[model samples]
Target chain A: MSPKTLYDKIWDAHVVHEDTDGTCLLYIDRHLVHEVTSPQAFEGLRMAGRKVRAPEKTIAVPDHNVPTTAGRENPDNMTEDSRIQVAALDKNAKEFGIHYYPVTDVRQGIVHIVGPEQGWTLPGMTVVCGDSHTATHGAFGALAHGIGTSEVEHVLATQTLIQKKSKNMKVEITGKLLPGVTAKDIVLRIIAETGTAGGTGYVIEYCGEAIRDLSMEGRMTICNMAIEGGARAGLIAPDETTFEYVKGRPHAPKGAQWEAALNWWKTLYSDDDAHFDKVLTIEGESIEPTVTWGTSPEDALPISALVPAPEDFKGGKVDAVRRSLDYMGLTPGQKLSDIEVDTVFIGSCTNGRIEDLRAAAAVLKGKKVKDGMRAMVVPGSGLVRAQAEEEGLADIFKEAGFEWRLAGCSMCLAMNPDQLAENERCASTSNRNFEGRQGYKGRTHLVSPAMAAAAAITGKLTDVREMM
Target chain B: MDKFEKLTGIAAPLPLVNIDTDMIIPKQFLKTIKRSGLGVNLFDEMRYDRQGNEIEDFVLNKPQYRETEILVAGDNFGCGSSREHAPWALKDFGIKAVISTSFADIFFNNCFKNGILPIVLPQEAVDTLMKDAEKGSNARMVVDLEEQTVTTSDGESFSFEVDPFKKHCLLNGLDDIGLSLEKVSSIDSYEEKASQARPWV
Candidate 1:
């Protein structure tokens, strides 16, 4: 047999039919829907008089619109549109005979976190969601990507998608990451090198020693922001770390089924001689606890570097630099360490996992948040929150002057009340630094959980390494 | 969905690069499931001020471009998020087509399903259309899907490419899901084989 990339092997296996125009019908294994995007897709299905072809294969998760505060028990008290969107999901799930985990349910969380926790996401399967962070499931080697709600409806009516193949690119990381550097830093560094639009029309497969050294949660942080780099999807070949995480989960195969699954999954990696369209390599030792100074993910630089001037750019780059600097309200030669922030947000699907909290808690231990600075730590899932409490991480956060909130995508995109003030600078662990992402006119600087803790302690964008 | 053959209407010019979906529709306005009401809030942060007054300085709110029927944007328009609402808001605002130097892959695909034609042209061609669009409401442009061409009112024509399958669906107003379901038998057989070979999955 010819050597094939991991993507090619999975894609070829799922092709239902190939059309002459280089498009094919690919069978979908699982469909994950959230509150904000699924309502309209459900409406489209009803308008067409079409019932879901495979309700058993779909899971409805209502996370994006739910309130993270304690008073969320009464959905009516929520904002009008938010209540309507969430209530619509409950009704749609009942009408469509699909599984749903509402905010009241213990299982409810960010779709990306809950899907894998419940074992609904498996290796070698194709996963589709209406949210861009659907790529988070690619940590298990699934061919996962975000789709429009129109495609959501299409998938609901038929358990397949009319997808065209994408080019395959590999990013190889060599050497070992420095102690303070993390999975988020590596992905941020890659995005900075590749730029925001670099991965267009391609699937990025993260490989090599540094990638293999990370845990399943760490790998997920890398895959979650592949869309920020403009990649269609990000993948990491499943290995022992992936298998161990899936072994005893609720939906994972039980008893003898596990043996059979692992036996097949062992062959899911790419062969040494597999051909790739493009391969970019990075030295992991060069990575630092990175931070974004501008509005885009690709606008990151190491803490040691100063904000780059627009004049330092070439090829008509001044426009982008000037716009980002103008919006972020940063000077051209400003150093990241000299920047002070009004708030620190340590949550998001990107860094709200238990491991992320552990990293942050390690820095916050025996320390107090700076005076007049507000900080919050919101876990990604109810499950992660429980694990954090079990480890006493929640108490550590509270003692350190960081507000501990219930689980959701709180302060990530700030759909709920957890938001930054007008013109307030924030050190956030969430993915994007797009202008006003957290709130109206709120300036955000993206960092890792450890760095967010360091920023809180110092009231500025301080390096986590020296603090540690 | 609306069928696309040709269109002639005023084109709005937005020359900013990486016009992400969040910019088109902020998270605050993403609450409603309905697509129609979003037009009023299109470009919510950019089009409106903190107190909800229209920011007249923004291009879309200008008197001449308020009723824009087509959009001539910069490179990588709709560059972030996979929200179909971006196209929904565009269609709700009476935009029949969007012309850009290039588009993010997910957004480009979403436009077709929502009856918005996304045209990809070279930078030089886009610059020409953008200049023509600056002429305000009088500079109406034409997009002919049948010919795969976009023409400015000034007699400049630029040919483009479209996927034959997407083109067929748009022209006939055919069901994309129905066409995909035509291979139900093949899908069932493959599933049967897969389940048998890998029963644990």
Candidate 2:
């Protein structure tokens, strides 16, 4: 028999029982809910006369539809739609007796960011949220991933989820990362190599020299995009770096319990000679500043690579290629570097960490955004915002003509009032560049935070290497 | 109450991959957290043309697929950000089940809460279902919630299994909150005793 991977071990430990249909009733350790997906579940509960089973284990936060700029003072600043949504979330959380971090609470931001900042994210835990970016918590060595609304309700009621075990995939990146290369670049390169659906049905364990050297923030940026590559979750085994980050946090265990927890987390790594369903390796040196040229994250290339021609997709996918180009208003064979952007957005759970802001600020030092270019920088969380301000990064952004705003999922998926006008192009640090992702008919070019800052300064898709 | 043991209806075909939440319900409509009243605007951008008129070429616009209760979608049916509204919109559009080779993790789970069954069949199973659904409006398919089986008008039957716990919850219309409330009496009793004993509250 082959040695089991860490995913298999963790999954086995959580399995309650296998149902007749082959799906296992796995116990969930933590449940995170948001306003956008919780209302219907709450309504379902009401109609059925149900009460939240373990309200203490469930946490709710309003992020997706809240206006990033509006604090508690001007609730009216939130659009009528978002305001209603936020209010509904608040009502449901209160009625159900679930702990809610409302927007009025200074700790509120994106659910993914809130989970870790509140010390709710811990190793060896099974965390589920209604948002796909729930995989962001996997950075803590937890078995975290997103689920559906029904599952959300199920977990809320039973503190458990029905799931099938996923296969294991190991993605190893070796070699020292060159300067100016960030985890965003690493994930983009991974997606570019593996296509969008490469890791389907697999839990990806990122390993090797490059991953071991990454800070918790960098590891988070890598794991945040696991869904983009079709992975259920991406994880890094706990190490000294992980311990240092979690020690003395608000919710982390203290003293002897903390030592015991650290011992268990240290053993969460894949066993020697562990077997994986699939394995892929990439060299860190081969990676360069990356960006998405087409609609999908997989439709990406290094800054040096030219935009693909329609004919390049010689197979039946020519239609897809043509459709993406037409939607993006890009001509075939045009260099991706030559594309001009009307706006620059730096936010979203994917790249809204303090480190992301610092990277952008470093690129924007003494450089101003071009006139007429709309640039907005929203931090991922209040904690991150405070740290950025303490370091004077917010001033650098404000001086550079970028609107430094409060924390929320701003300009990412255009859920709130912050949206792009029709047909406007934006260079964004957020994930996903699907048609009208920022707004209806809006074109988004996905890039790293530093790259977004460079584009804001130049008013085009200029190379960050050149600016550096 | 009439038990909804099975659902049978015309199938709508959406062949696109990665039909994200934004396309299902544009962010503009996300203002209201309420799950109801979103079905009409479901697929608004695709259902209408640039002039805001209903597009004749769109699948939902066709009279045949207007009452479609089942959706036969392509691979990667739900990709991109996790928004529960995607499933809510699909349920509101009367799609009770979606048959696809694959689905995004979040969207697949969301289907169950809205009374939508997301079936993840193999590629071969999906191709067969797609062909049956595309045979026009009269191609009625039956999805037996009780048996976890899908039978087409052509006399073909495929059995898919769901967790008995989930099936039980769906059948009785019980949700997480409902299950917890079943023990409310015990909880109240325990709380009464604890408060009397401690008197801290």
Candidate 3:
């Protein structure tokens, strides 16, 4: 057989059936569900009179709409819509015989983080969820991507999804990263290099010296925003780091089974002669702590840069730049680091892990959040929150005037009480910086956790290196 | 699902790049379990002011474009989030088709599943249709899936490519789950083999 990429090897292994037109029925090894997207899917299943094909392989959690406040036990305090959605998930999970993590469950948190923490998202598996950030699981070498509600219902009924193979694109990051630079910066830089739609029809496999050196958490941060760069999925080959991360979690294979899985996972890399449709290389040492200055993730620039003028862009982009500047209330030549923020949010599927919390805590140590600026730290999952408390990271945040909250997708998308008022500017550690993503008329500037911490201290988009 | 062989309707022109899903239907509207009733909130922020009044200048709010069944939008339409609510809102608003230079992969797929045909044309063709669509309610555009062509009111025509399988499914208004059930035996055998090979999963 010809040489195969890591994606090819995984895709071939999961094919249940194929058509002459290159369409394949890919078997899904794991399905992660959340409240917001699963309600309609469960309704669709009921309307069709179907049963969940593999309930054991499916897991449900309510993250997007649950309030991150301390008093979340009483559903009455939640907005009517939020209350209904969470209740619907509770009903659906029980009816479908799916494993569910309720708001009170310590295991409950963002589905993306919870899946990996539980060892349910393993290497070489085809994982899927209804949220676009499902690409977060690809860090484990799983062929994971987001699916629509229709696909969600279909998967519930048939453990299979219809898919066409995407062209393979190789993104190589060479050299060592700068001290303050992080996985989030590398990904933001990648999106800035490849415009928003550059990876539209391909799956990017990130590889090279820098990529190999990242922890599984860091790799996940890079893959989490593959959707922002317009790729449905991004992948990294499974190595020792991947195996070590998966070793003793609840769902991981034990003893002999673990040894067998490890042996197979060792072979999950791309062959030397594997063909790639496109290749892009970035010098890791060149990346700085990056942040988005516009509504799109592609509007990222180094913290040392200035707000770009519309004239700095050309053709159709000029109008977009102008619109973004107007919406962000930014002047053309303003320094990025000088812009003040009304809020600082430090958590999400993107940077809610223990490593991210530690990064932020290190920056906040012995420092206080700027006066009058509201800041909060929401861990990615309940377990992550517990670990942070055990590590005493939570106390550091609280002492610094940051509200350390329970785990969920707090202000990332703001379906809960953690929302921005109209025109409130926030420096966040979430994925998308799209208009109104954090709240109504909320302005979001995406950054890494440490950068968010720096912003909290300075009340602006500050460079972490400066704080260091 | 509904069969979409052809559609001839008033087209609304929205030429903004990166029209993200959050713009199509905001997160606040996603709490519902039903797919219907979202049309009222389609482009909710752009369509209405903070006080809940319609922004008259927004194309869809204009009288001529009120009943638009097709959209001539900018590149990378539906560019963020896999809400699937984006397509649901568009379909609920009675948008039968959309023409663009490019589309994000997940949005393009969701469009088909929701009976919305997202047509990809060259920049020139889109420019022509965009200008033609600006002519208001009297101007009409036709999309024929069988013929694989989009014709403007002025008789200009352009052909577009679509996957044969997706085209077939759209033509028949097929239920994907029902179709997959046809091969249950194959799925069972594959699962059995996979389990034997890797029982830990």
Candidate 4:
């Protein structure tokens, strides 16, 4: 057999057929659907008069556009528009024989977080969602990517997608990471180096010492924002770290089946002489706790650096930088560390896991959020919320004057009522700082969860590494 | 999907990079499954003031652009979030074509599926269109899909590329579901074999 990358191995395994025109019917192991992107897909199915080809392989959950008010009494209280969308999902799933977790269901949460926590994501499988952060599932060694609603419709009807094969790119980080630097910082650094569209037609595989050393949660944080760097998907080959995380979860194989699955997973990695279309290497030791000062994820810099001037950017990118500065109300040639934030959010699919909460708690223990600053921590899922409570991570956040709320995307997207006020600047631990993403006129500066916690205490874009 | 053969309409200029889906239709309006009735909410936040009053400064809210059926936007148009609502909203707002230097992969595909022609031109071509769009209702650019060209109202012309398969799909209003159903027997056989091999899944 020819030496192949892990992506090629998995992708080839699932390709049903490839046409002469380069169209493929790629089998999907898991199809995760959400409220925002699935309604029209279901409508497409209804219009086509077809049924889901494999209802057993599909899992439906409503996360986006769901209210996160903690202990909401009735579905009636949800905004009329949101209520319509959520109810439509419930109606669609029941009609199509797909399992749905409504807000009332305990398993209901963000699809990306819930998929891994429940073990629906396994090694060497292809997963997809209507949501872009579906790349988060790739951490488990699955080939996953976001699809447009039309593709969502195609997947629902056929249990397979007409996909184009993406090029393979290898990004190796060779040195050890500093203490306060995290997967969030490393991923932001990768994007800053690659520019937003550098990965346009590629599927990136993160490898070498730094990526291999990360825990499963850390790897997920990196994969979740692979789309932010314009990659179709990002992957990390499943090692023992990946196996250990998936071993005992609800949907993981058990008994003798587990042994067989592990044996297959062991062979799922790329061979020693695997080929790649492109390769990039980064020295990890020098990376600082990074943060974004501009709109795009690629607009990131080390926390130790000053805000960049338009001249610092070259060619077509300078206009983007100047526009970002204008929208963010930031001045070039200014220090990023001195920028004050009125809000700090410490959760998202990017860094709202148990380990992320622990890291934040480690920094915020016995400290307090700055006066007149509003800070909050919304866990990604109910399970993460429960684990945080069991470990008293919630109490630490509350004690530090941060509002500890229920699990949801929360201020990460402002889908619910949790949003930034007009012109409010937020130090956020989520992906994407696009203008008005948090809310109308809201400004976001992306950082790690620990950096967000530190900023909450200092009321500025403080470097978590300096405090450590 | 609506048939998209050719169009010549006034183009509105929205020169901002990363014009994400959230800003296109917004999460607030994503509730309804119906693609219609979204034109009122297109660029809801930018077109309307906080009090829900129209912001006269917004191009779409201006009287001259009220009937715009073409859009000339900035680079990386329709980036962020894989909501088809972005294209749906634009289509509902009577936009038949969107011209930009580049587009995000998902949004670019979504546009073709939803009967909106997303044209990718160079920065200079987009600049010329932006200037022409600034001329308001008088500037009507012709987008001839058959000829693979976009001609300015003053007869300046630029050619663009489109994937041949997608171009075929758009020309005939072909949907992927109808196309995939062609392999139903092959799909069923594969599923049976797959189930036998991986029953635990």
Which candidate's DockQ is highest? 3
DockQ of each model vs. true complex: 0.69, 0.31, 0.82, 0.58
Worst 10 residues of 3 chain A by lDDT: A313-322
Docking class of 4: medium
> A1-468 in candidate 2: lDDT tens per residue?
667787876786566555566677676767888887777678777876767877877889887877777454376777676777788888998888988887767788888888887777887777889878888888878888887666677677666676777889999999988776789989989988876778777899999899899988888888889989888898888788888888887767787677767767777888899988899899988888888888888888887777787788643246677888888998877888899999999989999988899999999999899989999998988788888999999999999999988888879878777888898999999888887779888899889999999999989887898988
Model 4 DockQ reads: 0.58
Instruction: State the lDDT of candidate 1 residue by residue for A1-468, as single tens digits.
Output: 989889898898788889888999998888998899899889989997999988988999778778887778698768888889988999999999998888878788899999999999989889999989999999999999999998999899888899999998999999899999999999999999987778888999999999999999999999999999888999999999999999899888888888888877888988889888988899999998899998888899998789999888753246777888988889978898998998999988899889999999999999999999999998888899889999999999999999887778878888877888888999999998887788988899999999999999999999999986
Give me the displacement of residue A291 in model 2, in angstroms.
Answer: 0.7
The interface root-mean-square deviation of each model, in the order shown, is: 1.5, 5.8, 0.9, 1.8
Task: State the displacement of the C-alpha of residue A374, model 1, in Å, after optimal TM-score superposition.
Answer: 1.8
Better of 1 and 2 by DockQ: 1
Residues A55-174, model 3: lDDT tens digits:
999999999989998889798878899999999999999999999999989999999999999999999999999989999999999999999998999899999998999999999999
- Residue B57, candidate 3: alpha-carbon lDDT: 97
Lowest summed lDDT window (length 10), candidate 4 chain A: A64-73
lDDT, each prediction:
0.88, 0.80, 0.93, 0.87
Task: Give lDDT tens digits, candidate 2, residues B1-201.
Answer: 112457889987776766766778776766654666878888888887667899898888898888988988877777776677787788777778888877776676667666677777777777788889887698899888788888888978888867576577666665544454454464455445633432211
lDDT of 1 by residue, B157-191 (tens): 99999999888888877768878778889888877
- Which scores better on DockQ, 1 or 3? 3
Clash counts for the predictions, in order: 0, 10, 0, 0
What is the Cα-based TM-score of model 3?
A: 0.99
